[model samples]
Target: MIRTFAFDVGETLVRDDRYWASWADWLHVPRHTVSALVGAVVARGQDNAEALRLIQPGIDPSAAYQAREEAGRGEHLDETDVYEDVRPALSALREAGARVIIAGNQTVKAGALLRALDLPADLIATSGEWGVAKPSPAFFERLVAQADVPADEILYVGDHPQNDILPAQAAGLRTAHVRRGPWGCLWADDPTVIEAADHRIDSLTDLIPLAGQ
Candidate 1:
């Protein structure tokens, strides 16, 4: 009886190849070098922040992110940035009477970017707006309030095992592990993490049938 579906943005609905490339450009390093560094960090179960700092010591993360924002402004998400299955999948869920929303940890400009791209989501929300990030009980509580439903009736779909799957499940929402993004694939083989998700999807299209559409 899932009545609502909340999706994660980055690497779940969209892939930001240029975002990391821009970081490389700012660091004056080869894009592959930076990309590989990020992969290495994730391989060791470290997060992106650790990877960035390891690659460029003394790199001010906020400043680096501001640069990414500047570089990303005019270059909004194009066809390639979005996953091929997102549009059709979201449409199917919406057609099935699901209230589909997108929520994630993103920069303040996320709203603008989402508006510019005009994705299929009925609503888009960010951690910036809520002043809290995922894995915070308050964040999920806010989502429950926003959705106006019991937590058990909501479905949260995201790529991150710890941030999305575990936290959302703990918050009483059925969780879906979308196996596409950095964190998704990184923990794909972990039985503990994988089994925690009520549903597992390699493609967003898989959600269509799962949502009873």
Candidate 2:
């Protein structure tokens, strides 16, 4: 029985394609170019913080990212959604007796996505707050401690194999590969990236059954 669940926000819980497209439009750059910049940096697989900085210089990408999130709370939220099914999915998980929590490896505005979603996150594990990024196992450690759950009883669902999946698996937590098609899985399947998950869900609503502890 899974006692708790930690969800990743960007690609996992919230789907905001237009926001980036808007940026691409604003920057007069191809969306694929932006995607390639991120992909190239991620291919290097450096520390999470370093990776965010490598792709975006000058501004602390993490902090700048969060600022955008904060701004979204007031406006720009229409560009995204927390996934209409999220509430029912989380409610179903709770009905099955699982505590739902939110965690992310955002540079700065990691918390903003959760806040915008207005989900009742029992705990939030953010990379910006910890100053370390994912796949390090540190961010998961913080969230697990904050949620006060035994590692084995907690399940983490995410789109990023390195940032969310592997680290959670290493922390002794069960992992559910939330394969969201485009965002992160464009290269290959989630297993290709993490290769350690115990389960797979193509959508957020699929977690209904495992919410039971």
TM per model?
A: 0.91, 0.75
**Which has the greatest TM-score?**
1
**Cα lDDT tens digits for candidate 2, 37-140:** 65566567644345345445564744655565576522244324566667777767766767888777653444664565567566655677778767777777
TM-score of predicted structure 2: 0.75
lDDT of 2: 0.67
Candidate 2 has its poorest 10 consecutive residues by lDDT at 72-81
Q: What lDDT does model 1 reach?
A: 0.83
Clashing pairs in 2: 62-107, 62-108, 66-109, 96-212
Tell me the lDDT of model 2 at 13: 67
Q: CA RMSD for every model?
A: 2.1, 4.1
Q: Pick the candidate with the highest lDDT.
A: 1
lDDT scores of the candidates, listed in order: 0.83, 0.67
Report lDDT (Cα) of residue 16, candidate 1: 65
